[model samples]
Target: MNAPFPIRKECPPGACVCNRQALLSDPQADIRILKLTREEESRLLARLETLSSLADLKKMESRLHEQLGIVLTITPSIHEVRTLRGISIQLQEQPGLCRKTKQAIPAAIRRSLEKSPDIAYAILDAHGLWDGT
Candidate 1:
């Protein structure tokens, strides 16, 4: 008797564990690139500008600390005025905070960037991809 042939199972093209076949045929598939409209671009640019200004301010603060021995505390108004967003900057004087507080500053910046209107639009577009938008 001949040895039993091995059984083969194959998935159709465009079909996978997530069953993305229907999604692949979406007419608005190019929406991903198109979602970043001019308005959204401008908003993101504005946020970036604010971030750059904040960086400059932080540098100035550091210089003041070194030259004048004045520790500049980051207040809410100053943060908003500098960045146009309420991003917290970890300071040394604040007790009970982490030792390397400066490391947490980047995370605050990242969180603010993620909350930008342009980023929110991009996230919405990504979610729509699965819905065949």
Candidate 2:
């Protein structure tokens, strides 16, 4: 399957720690997926398993890193009013649900980091995110 969302090639989103270099200036762009219900999940899986490979998983996961929230470390133990802080607060308050992407990240991140200068590898451990690895 093709990527449901766009992956930045030039200025990647993880550029701060990676190598975006002001390449992607997506102000309001969102990486979205069709939230599949239980029935939808079963249906899609059946169709995908019939003719999909691991390459599809890898590509989709790679795109996810660029799709979701950008990497921004929140300064803990100190209250600082900043644009990053605003984003952090909003994320905590109104995070939405995502469907099963069946994609992985660690392998994808490592792959991208080793091969592409535009992609940076940063370790972020969170729930509700699929790292197909």
Model 1 C-alpha lDDT per residue in residues 1-133, reported as the tens digit of each score: 1113321122345442322233234553322222223454345335433443444445645753563233445433322233424433444442111222234343444454455545333333343423653
* TM-score list, all predictions: 0.21, 0.20
Q: Across residues 1-133, which tens digit of lDDT does each residue of candidate 2 receive?
A: 2334444233234432322222223433332322333454455444433323334434443443354442212221234323222212111211222211223222233344334322221112132122676
Report per-prediction Cα RMSD to one decimal. 23.5, 17.0
Error of 2 at 91 (Å): 17
Residue clash pairs of candidate 1: none
Off by over 4 Å in 2: 1-34, 59-94, 98-133
TM-score of 2: 0.20
Evaluate all candidate structures by whole-model CA lDDT and list the values in order. Answer: 0.37, 0.31
Which portions of model 1 show Cα errors greater than 4 Å?
1-52, 77-133
